[model samples]
Target: NDPLLGVPIPEVTSEQSSSMASPQSNVQTNHPMTHHNNKWTKDHPLNYIIGPLSRPVSTRLQLHEQALFCYYDAFLTSVEPKTYKEALTQACWIEAMQEELSEFERLEIWELVPRPDKVMVITLKWIYKVKLDKLGGILKNKARLVACGYRQEEGIDFEESFAPVARLEAIRIFLAYAAHRNMVVYQMDVKTAFLNGYLREDVYVSQPDGFVDPNNPNHVYKLKKALYGLKQAPRA
Candidate 1:
């Protein structure tokens, strides 16, 4: 009787079952628990334990198990870098930084210029992050070159510090309205958000570490758009 092919097991006779059912009965019953030996699978109440079933696994079942393991293996993710120095040493982090710089250039976030006299040039730092999917698997590595906005003066760098953010109640109301109208809701991801906001103040920042140009080592980046760390970035 093969278990893998769903073959039915041979049922014991009613007379043999009655003898095995009684705990006080001393009569022996023909219950084939062991394979041709009485060395294992004892019928004692104290020592009675179900043993491993001897079954044949088909080739298809073996392949399916292998495929299941491979599918879950994709969720394995790498660790995030702690600093720019650590990030520069790895190829994956270098690619992430490159992607960030490319987006900045595409958006015309800053322009290269000589260091202005008596001007406060903010230093930039590389922020490393591991972007993950909903299932917790790594989607990609994220790098952001952010300005030191803490050095910014209230009136000089920014005026009003405010960003329009939706409230919890407003979100709930919107969801309720959408449900009432039978709307199909979809999420839109804004990759480079603050970088797209136009900057009113002339914010100058040092070139990103590890990617500093040899030709313009003393040059600073005059920001044309809002930076990540800027107080007025979300407002802009």
Candidate 2:
């Protein structure tokens, strides 16, 4: 065995020799500044960016797009009004409320009368909602005036409160029967719904905020038809 042939020579090659000559240059360890400069080279995804912390500040187009998507995010909304005062501030909400009142008038839901003595007048609450299309764009502004029936006594305001709705089991059974009979069941929604019901019990509700009749500011509404928040609304 040739010891010289078998033993590995630790001779520095051109690349190694150059590297050794100026270790700082060739074997480049990052300086503090350089480390910081290259530290965030990795892509920052939106999953980590989160909210207004690092939100895009590129262009007006982006700003407009951000507003459109603010429905899914952000603290403030443009359409939904939390209070009647707030609702009155926006024309759209005002129009929606007017429309709702118009519906009430058309359906003869209530009659304006002098404030009843010793009778409880349930306060009305205004709920403002923006109806959105399937694609997330707003379709219309919906305003609902609901009676606060919490103050109503069980026997006085209502004898029984029940929802006139089909059970899930019944619905499923009907669907199954339809399928078995090979009948194509057509679905329809009642546009519909509540105001048609006649209220047997006497229910008094306060006039809506920002819409109190100037002539009859002290007048209250005597509800003949079931309103949104009445306990007997669904059944009446």
Candidate 3:
């Protein structure tokens, strides 16, 4: 026999039946009544909860599509050459290197002098690289003249070679301090950073390849300022 069998059924009054049938009365049902109603219903709790979820998914999809379109547009723009002169200049690596060497000499990074007796002279060479923009487009050609510092003897050729440089944390701290003081920060770069440092030791370097002095081909350079690839060059 069932436990609820033989239990007396309570008679429903007119007011109680009316209240039970009303929509407001359904909302006021206890937890047990609501749970039982949901179990028998076709619509589950998850169905109602998922109604507001479509908006963020749609927004994210639109953002991804927009980013892809922008990337494609930028790629096509970079692939299209802007002018005929730019196209021609891009093919001239030797000319670019020569021009860079001329600029380096004009900046007075070193003085052309006779190769001194019993003094070690570092060999120099031209290094070529292509400059690129943030969007991966070729911006310009770059040429650097670097010295072979491996041949340099530590104490005999140079002394006290280490140069101090500001760390990234120090730079961040400086910017934060400036911001706290409510000041605007500006940035400027030296055209040739190594060329600005005064050299204490007597250092000499050979003329860059393909750029021998027209009047004095036999002479080497006595460096007054630091050169790229020098072991003791100062850092800015």
Instruction: Compose the digit string of candidate 2's lDDT tens values, residues 1-236.
Output: 77688778788789887666565575546644433442332366657654564444446798788787775443234458788888776677888889999988888888999998989999999988888789987788899988888888888878999987799999999999999999999988865378889989888899988889999999999988898888999897
TM-score computed on alpha carbons, candidate 1: 0.62
At residue 4, give the lDDT of candidate 2: 89
What does the lDDT come to for candidate 1?
0.81
Quote each prediction's TM-score. 0.62, 0.64, 0.57
Off by over 4 Å in 2: 1-79
Ranking by TM-score: 2, 1, 3
Cand. 2 Cα-lDDT: 0.81
Query: Candidate 2, 140: how far from true, in Å?
Result: 1.6
Instruction: List, in order, the clash count of every candidate structure.
Output: 0, 0, 0
Per-model RMSD to reference: 18.2, 12.3, 17.7
**At residue 204, what lDDT does model 2 achieve?**
89
lDDT of 3 by residue, 169-208 (tens): 9999999999999999999987767877878888899987
Q: Cα deviation in Å at residue 29, candidate 1?
A: 59
Off by over 4 Å in 3: 1-91, 167-169
Q: Which stretches of candidate 1 lie over 4 Å from their true place?
A: 1-77
- The TM-score that candidate 2 achieves is 0.64
